[model samples]
Target: MQGLTPTESISFILVFLEGILSFFSPCVIPLIPIYISYLAGNAKQVAEDGTITFHRKKVFFHTLFFVLGISFAFFILGMSFTALGTFFQSNQLLFTRIGGILILILGLYQVGLLDIKFLQRERKFQIPLGDREANPLLAFAMGFTFSFAWTPCVGPALSSVLILASGTGSSLTGNLLVLVYSLGFVIPFLLLGLFTTQVLNFLNVHKKFLKYTVKAGGILLILIGIMTFTGWMNGVTKYLSKFTPPALTREEENLPPEESDTASESDSAENSEAKEEPVKTPAFDFTLTDQFGNEHTLSDYKGKVVFLNFWATWCPPCQMEMPDIEEIYQEFDKNEGDIVILGISNPSSAEYPDNADKSKEEVLAYLEDNKYTFPIVFDETGEVLQDYFISAFPTSFFIDKEGNFFGYATGLMTKSQIYQALEQALAATEQPSE
Candidate 1:
């Protein structure tokens, strides 16, 4: 099997961060202090001055053992999920649907719409020995028990890992992958334990900030839930294929053409034809309807320079880039006949049930809430996305006025970058440069 791509590695790192954030959730956030306190209490007695002194070496080793224990538990969980996924690979869609439903239920729980008794269960593991006699193995067991008991708090993060594992199509590999994910969470906690007093003091002073942070974390979980349950992640992946390096696209394009040839002579002829045919760079065309029911086709503005964007209300990066897109849009909207800017709302499936036929009303509400006033379209059925082949949020296509595609961006674009691209597109239009 091919090694994971750079993009996949980056995505995994983001997954790791998501795991860390989930570990710092409301239920788990406040308890970090308590855990530290418990560990601190286990410290050895100080001199007669009444100061408590901890054996730093012992503390460090204990924390490390605890992290190892937590990591082991997650490794086992990942292995189990991977095995189950392998067994059910024949029913991939059924598994995906089931996972989606479970994610949705979890989201509902986060939003206070639903609750599960088992999910609320929080059992702590205890070591039946003195701290002085505590073996690393016992500490590790406690760590495993801690992780198992806190399943609800870590469910969102674990779910993400499980989703990735299931998609990997290999049980052992997938399980190991999630074990790495568990380390991403455990490492931070172990470090915090090393500076227990400092961290506890900081948390105590900034308790209000911590509350909001946990709230934000909860909201993020909810977002992840929506993305998972609605199949938005799959859609994003599909869209991202559009921006895959040209080499991969060319190779893929030639695959089907090659498969169709039977005879050697036919294959030679097809190869000749392939050599002659220019590699076509991907482009996007979509129809957007305004609140007034006016329809606009991106292709209709072909003779004019255009900026095409894919975005959604719930996406933070999308939202962050909007004001910049809007600033550029305003500059060009005034010169609409020369440059056209079209922003398309790419809602996750959970947010848009009808898919491509997503209502114009919802778009309006989104616009109003986000304070965006650009020419916006809805890619409910993802037909427009199919043409563009985008994978990430805020993909922008810069088309020259002569209908020649100049270039595109796959992630968030800064205001200056948008302006620079627009300026380049405009200059290309005026000079007819390659």
Candidate 2:
């Protein structure tokens, strides 16, 4: 609930400038004229002579609704970030570390150090020109939907802003931050729509140099990510702390017990009523086809320690964990046959609904492009996915040398965590069985 500090006021100006730079990014700038034309319903306005013949009123109103639509979308995103931060307030430091690493990767991708092709894939939401022109409502809806298609530059900048907004400890503050960002973003578009011909001329004249805009944005994004990772904001935060007023002192007293806590203890006793029962399970086995057409059966790898990972190329956590998985798997030679790693990617097991419909060819290409040396499988029918009951991507299960179900983890795991799991699985191989 604190107001903006001097440093924050300065940061907001930078955020706004970054928004302008995002407007000039390669993905968005070239398409600006088309968007203007679509909204104005005046394709001939920016013709060879740069006539600027569009109806001013129509352009202004259309662009206004468009701006409102995207701004609303951004506000909702801000609320979501605030809610997420609230839920993880107890673990904010850990949450920040994870966010920092992700932002760093995105920065690297933006700078061309990493070529994550999927990140560059824009959502192809092409509304028919006639449809938009015929109905202004459709034009407004187009603007609303287009907000979801955030380009690479805007994505990282917005992410950084959301991090700051979330730390404000108030949902209203978070929403305002996004509104400010959208305001900073929407102003340029409004201007460009008003003066389409001149803007196009300016853009065309400076087309060659505009390429550096994205690079510069990428560099700035990288710095923000580094600052976040190293907690460089602390010094600035310390300065801002001086402005905060002291709270009136209150008398201390013993607090009453929470009902939910008492109820939960009673509930725990009731829940344990079924705990006396034990169920026997049979050994799990399944086969899947590798990318090269060879079949790998779990039964075939019996008596060897196995690291079974379920992952998808589109999953960021899956991608982040791959390097460590590769390193650990490489430690044991395949020729030795004592330790093995099997990566299973099922089309039907895609964790993200947006990435669910990926083609077999795409999956294969991604695997090959990444140059992963471990055995990979494409579960075309998802039969393996069914047998394992997997609903989350980047899930890992370790099987002991005796092929018993040793341990399993849901969601992402760090390199050290995976190694610890490995050590536990290795230890499982030595202990006497009951």
Candidate 1: residue pairs that collide: 239-390, 239-391, 240-390, 240-391, 242-389, 355-380, 356-380, 356-381
Candidates in order have lDDT scores of 0.54, 0.55
Residue clash pairs of candidate 2: none
Estimated TM-score per prediction?
0.37, 0.35
**Candidate 1 residue lDDT tens string, 1-434:** 01111111224555566667757654345345334544544544446984444556666677788788878766655443345533433343344455445445544554456667643321111221124344577668767655644444455456445534533323444666676678678877788667754554565567677666544545655554455445555544444333433211111123342342233235434544554432222234556675446698767886788777776554566778888877777777543668888877654455555343235566678678877777786666655653453444556767777564565655566676567567656764586322
> Roughly what TM-score does model 2 have, to 2 decimal places?
0.35
> What does candidate 1 score on TM?
0.37
Error of 2 at 42 (Å): 68
lDDT of 2 at 367: 77
Best by lDDT: 2
Per-residue accuracy of model 2 over 1-434 as CA lDDT, tens digit each: 01111111224565566566556644355345446646655332434874435556776777888888767655655443345533433344454555456556656765678876554332111221222341356556656554544422254455445544533324454566667778888888888668854554454567567557545656665665565566553323323323322111000112222442344346435534634321112235777788878888888877777888888776777889888887877787741557788888765333422223266677888878887778887777654553454444566767778675554554566776666556656765666533
